[model samples]
Target: MTEEEKKTADTGQQEEAKKPETSAEGTKEQKEEKASADTKPETEKKADGKEEAAAADASAKDDKKASFFKKNDKKEKELQDKIDALNDQLRRQMAEFDNYRKRTDREKEQMFSNGEANVIEKILPVVDNFERGFDTVQDEDKDDAFVKGMQKIYSQLQKELTDLGVKPIDCVGKPFDPSFHNAVQQVEDDTKESGTVAVELQKGYMYHDKVIRHSMVAVVS
Candidate 1:
């Protein structure tokens, strides 16, 4: 109603509106800090979960690599075993072939020796007849052309027999061995020892190292 009283009331209203409220501002700041604190724990838990998943994946990869290496080692061992078995089989086959070759060679040698001995045995009688015929020739006829031709032929026959590994056995004036000499008669001889060959009735022949024919002889008693 009075002018001064009205003026004072209007100034009080203006000051009250301009002044800040400390209690309301402090309460709003506290609520914002609590929201930030609550969000930090969730972010950290997500990071931890991602790290655990990465470690598990790495372990699985390592196990797979180890399995691959183990399989390769098993395959190598199997291949080596097969190679060793093949080598052993080849060695056994080579040894068997060598043994067979040696056996065949021995058989061939034995057959050849038997056949040569048989042929030489049949030819011995003809050689004895040739010697007997030569002994009957007279010394007066020795210079004749026919006798000379026969002597040359006999010499050629002896040379051929010598070339073929045939040789006459010594009987007269040598010891009488039953293997090489046949004693047809026993006689006394002062010039020779007892059981010695005094006379050779028929000559013996040897083919190589074998006696093809035995000498017919008279032994000193």
Candidate 2:
């Protein structure tokens, strides 16, 4: 062979070997790019999952807080209702006690007034006998020592009865009242008006403003 032709063939053979190495390097770069793409997607998915879990936990905590507040409010309402019921019961009991006290006081006062009236009614007969004994005395015996002593004793008794709120009812020269006077007989009298008391047959007595004994009288008609 010629030297120029051999040199040209050798240069062509070397260029063919360099073409295989270049192809291998291009294949390696394509594999590395594919692996980087797959890893990037997995990393983003993990970060998103962690963020979602955090949000769900925060929502659960908020729900628990709201439930706790609701329970507390219900318990407070129940306690307030119980307090109001107790206060109403206490007021009712106090009112009942006050009414009972007033009733007992009225009963005691009525009983005491009835007892006093009964005693005054029994003593009125003795006062009438004393006045009759004094009326039977004569004018000649009026200056006797025994009669004077009896007069003094009768005057003292009358003073004591007056001090105890006892007084004689006036029946003569006054209009006849059915409330204070009882007529035994009707009489015709020229000096007195009709339907009036002409004479007091028996004395009547009063205790304070109440008539203990009615006046026995003769009416002028």
Candidate 3:
């Protein structure tokens, strides 16, 4: 063979030996890129799971807070209702007590007035009898035993009437009052004023500071 042909054959053998080493390096680089891709997907999945758990926990806390507020509101409303009822009851009781006190006071006043009227009524007839006895007894016989006895009886009747809150109204020489004096006779008298009481014919009686009977009087002009 010629020397140039021998050189070309040796170069072809060297290129064949380097082909296996290049193929092995390319395979190792492909394996590393595949492993990196797989690890990125796993990391993303873990981050998504953590975010979902946080959201669930927040929702649970909000629900618990709402429940607590509702319970507290219900309790407050119940307490307020009870307080209002108690206040209303107390006001009603106070009004009842005031009414009772007023009624009792009125009753007491009426009882006292009634008692005075009753006592005066019983002694009125005795007073009338005394006046009749005085009219029958003469001034000349005033010193006599019968006259003295009648005077003593009249004085005792007066004392009894006074103790019972009975009083006599003076009509002689006083102005005529329709409330306390009843005109029984009319006379013309130049010495006395018109519509004035000149003389009292019958005694008037007052019971418990109130007029029970008016005096029978004679009016003059």
lDDT per residue for candidate 2 within 1-221, as digits (tens), equals: 89999999999999999998989998888889999998999999999999899999999999999999999999999999999999999999999999999998998976876677678778777777877887999999999998899888888888987987889999997889999999998999999899989999998888888888899999998
TM-score-superior candidate, 1 or 2:
1
Q: Which candidate, 2 or 3, has the higher TM-score?
A: 2
Note the clash tally of each candidate.
0, 0, 0
Q: What is the C-alpha lDDT of each candidate?
A: 0.87, 0.89, 0.87
The model with the greater TM-score, 1 or 3, is 1
lDDT of 1 by residue, 29-131 (tens): 8888888789888899889988899988999999999999899999989999999999999999999999999998999987897788787778777777777
lDDT-better candidate, 1 vs 3: 3
Give me candidate 1's TM-score against the actual structure: 0.69
Model 1 stretches with alpha carbons more than 4 Å out: 1-69
lDDT of 2: 0.89
Best by TM-score: 1
Q: What is the lDDT of candidate 1?
A: 0.87
* Cα error of candidate 3 at position 130, Å: 1.4
Against the true structure, whose lDDT is highest?
A: 2
- TM-score, candidate 2, is 0.64
